[model samples]
Target: MINFKIRYTLLLFAACISLQACKKAWQDHTAITIEALNKTLIQQINETPDLSTFSTYLVKTGYDKVLASSKSYTVWAPTNTAMQTIDAAILADTAKLRLFVANHISYQEYFTTAPNPSLVIRTLSGKNIIFTPATFEEAKIVKGNVYVKNGVLHTIDQASGTKQNAYEFMMSTGLSTKQRGFIQSLFHTEIDTSKGVKLYTDPITKKTIYQAGTTFPVTKNTYFQRVSDISSEDSLLTYIILSDVAYDAEKAKIGRYYNLSTSATKTDTLTQFAVVKDLVVNHVYTIDNLPDTLTTVSGVKIHLDRSAIIQTQKLSNGIAYVVSSIGYQILQNKIPVIYIQGELPDSVRVPSTLSIRTKKDLNDVKYTDMQSRSITSSPDPLYYYRYKTTVNSAQYKVYWRAVNDIFTTSFNQKVDFSATRYYPKAVETPLATMGYKAVAVSDYSEVYLGLYTPANYGTLYTFLVSATGVVSTAPSALSLDYIKLVPVN
Candidate 1:
């Protein structure tokens, strides 16, 4: 059976195709006069009340003169109904309305449809718009494509102040009282950065807001209670989305948002799984317009343990500004290092080789602390697991690919990994062939890398052979993690 969202997807796809044709025609033809097109559009608007905002928006945004000239484009015009919902005064103002209509105008006619998320679109004002279709593509596409005489318009549900896809609704209104109430109800303290995502008993109430194996701290509010609180008794607990696992083959890695959550339609591509599980415990949600209770704002680099963000700025609601004589400036570079472990293990033995999964788990197995995040832990959290050995069947093989090509042939320097030993990580490295080990890696697990990941995350030289492998020569792709646990029988 077709999903309900598919029809919407097809509509968006059709709209895109229409715009794409216009763009191609504009680029291929000579001086396609905008005056003729605008005349037709104005007539159409006269007959259609819904197009009034489109007409008014054109005039207010200073497009009358330009559209009356020679700019061939197609715009996905919003109906009068859509415009009626928007404030007329806001729509009537030239400068103010630009923000609302910014998504409507692309620079050229060629960009008739949304490309894959990576495709770049230059707006009429020369700004760039990225089409992100990670989730709800049909909804997003429907919201995005609107065609007009001179250009196409994509009508988003909300005015995302910062061009982010994560929080469209949240961006529409800044820091709602309900959101604030939610945060305050959990804990008054700022996020414990030492833990990427945190949860625990309320120090005051001891209500067990947090439970074992949660991601970010879940709230007692409406949103969380529905998804997480299966039993009514499960209510009142705050769950967190934790990205705490070491280079989890399934999760991608311990620290990052990219490639973790995806919506792919291909048969083999996985979809609908919670990239972020249990909202409150183990994850750090990216919040914009932090509440007024948060004072003396200072920016610090935050690592997202496990997060699913629309990553867009909602209307900057209720976000007060204070003038301190300092502006944002970029300076020194730093990277986060984690020493993964829990409590010390009592029994210990040395081995010849370590599996890859244990190493990744060790890297991810740290608890949030007071001083800093998982750099290392008490009695050193690093000394829990040791490297044993690679599978005896493991083969050292040369995987080659095209580095460059002059024609159909003739390329220089195919990517190679000869000197590097691809060892299974038992723990985060400073690895020793002999002597004592720092971290005790959990066994029967595995780590895998992507096409790209920041350095110092795991072993740079040796990558573990995982249950899954992509055909990439990048460091992240080769990096793998492994651990051992029981199977359901």
Candidate 2:
């Protein structure tokens, strides 16, 4: 009986030890499971002692629910000390506070070990924030890559300040008031057909008709629609805003080209738009990397003088320079060469009497040229091919290429200019003294016609007239390939 009691006591001791070990294992497993469930981004921010201010603002902005949801996000949480520097005006306004908070969060979970050295992250506020392993914008990351259940969190030393884009900067700055006002004047409202409500179908035309007032009016800017959209944060642009004195000076130079005898108001508006149109370039160029010459979106080349810059603003979207003056020459870059093809004339004296021939030249380059057909009559019929274009008030040097490949004999042609489209009663003076005389047979070279200055800045009519009106059955006719007018100051 004594031996049986000893064995039973030893078994009881072993059983108690196993029970204690099992309880300890169960407690460890429960702790791990609870930690895994509670370590979401919102919870992680709430638990961090230094991130209390950031956590509070997230809840106030209703972004706490967003971080707690399944969608991934990266939060650059500023410490309480960093939050102390925030503007009191931002906290007073709900919309401003929400925007300020949203600026710190982005859509994706970006870790510090990302392959890219830097990334342009689009934040929840719709503005872009630059992110690097060590920093977010100007704010230094104190503790980074804090992984959570939903996203990653990085503690920052300072809050990332919001910046205005190029368009916004121009509107807010007092120096750019003239440019801002001009751009604002281009705003107009148009009916948005996509938002219209369908009423009924027309029985006769079998078309759907929408309610008259169902569609809303959406405001649009002509400069934004037609030119580069500087307001968009997705693109980068370099905008130059001239001071009021410089603006008036630049307007005076470009005003001569847009001179209208009809309306003074229309002339002023055209001059203002032209001045503003060539000021915005597509790429962002800082003063350090700026080239000596930059081309505008309107295809005008402008000389960049660093000394002329009064203020330089580093915006979120791009850079803006307030300049005292812009260097733009009138003739060199503003006026472009005008080209007119012989076969594509606006009107011909007799369409049936002209033949457009396509042939290869001496260089084996294929080209199309217009040739006069057989006209057997007295006072040899003069064939006229008229071309029209708008010219600035500048002298133009005329050039023409008349390839005489079909006929063995050479032919002659002259050019005449007029303000009206219809044939003038008296033929104006010829462009060249010799009238592009005797275009050699089979010679495919451009002949220079002397310079001619237009009387005014408006629509110009160019008439290519046959120099010698020879009525013959043989192919001794005037032939031309193209005409070019190069502007001279």
Off by over 4 Å in 1: 1-49, 87-89, 92-94, 110-120, 125-303, 306-489
Give per-residue CA lDDT, model 2, range 1-489, as digits (tens). 999999999999999999999899545422222243448899988989999999999999999999999988989999999999999999889999998999999998787656278887889988888887678888987777777778888889998767788888989889867888999999999778797899999999997788988887899989988877888999878999899888888878888777776777877887898888888888989899999888999899997799999999887787899998998767747777788888988988753468898888889899998887443322333567888988876788888898776566765667878777765555543332225366688788888887877755678888877654352334345567988888886
Instruction: Give per-candidate clash totals.
Output: 96, 0
Query: Global lDDT for candidate 1?
Result: 0.31
- Which RMSD does model 1 reach against the true structure? 24.0
Residue 327, candidate 1: Cα error in Å is 27
Pairs with steric clashes in candidate 2? none
Residue-level lDDT of model 1, residues 102-169, one tens digit each, is 54444555332345544444445333344443212112433332334655443333332223222223
Q: What lDDT, from 0 to 1, does candidate 2 have?
A: 0.80
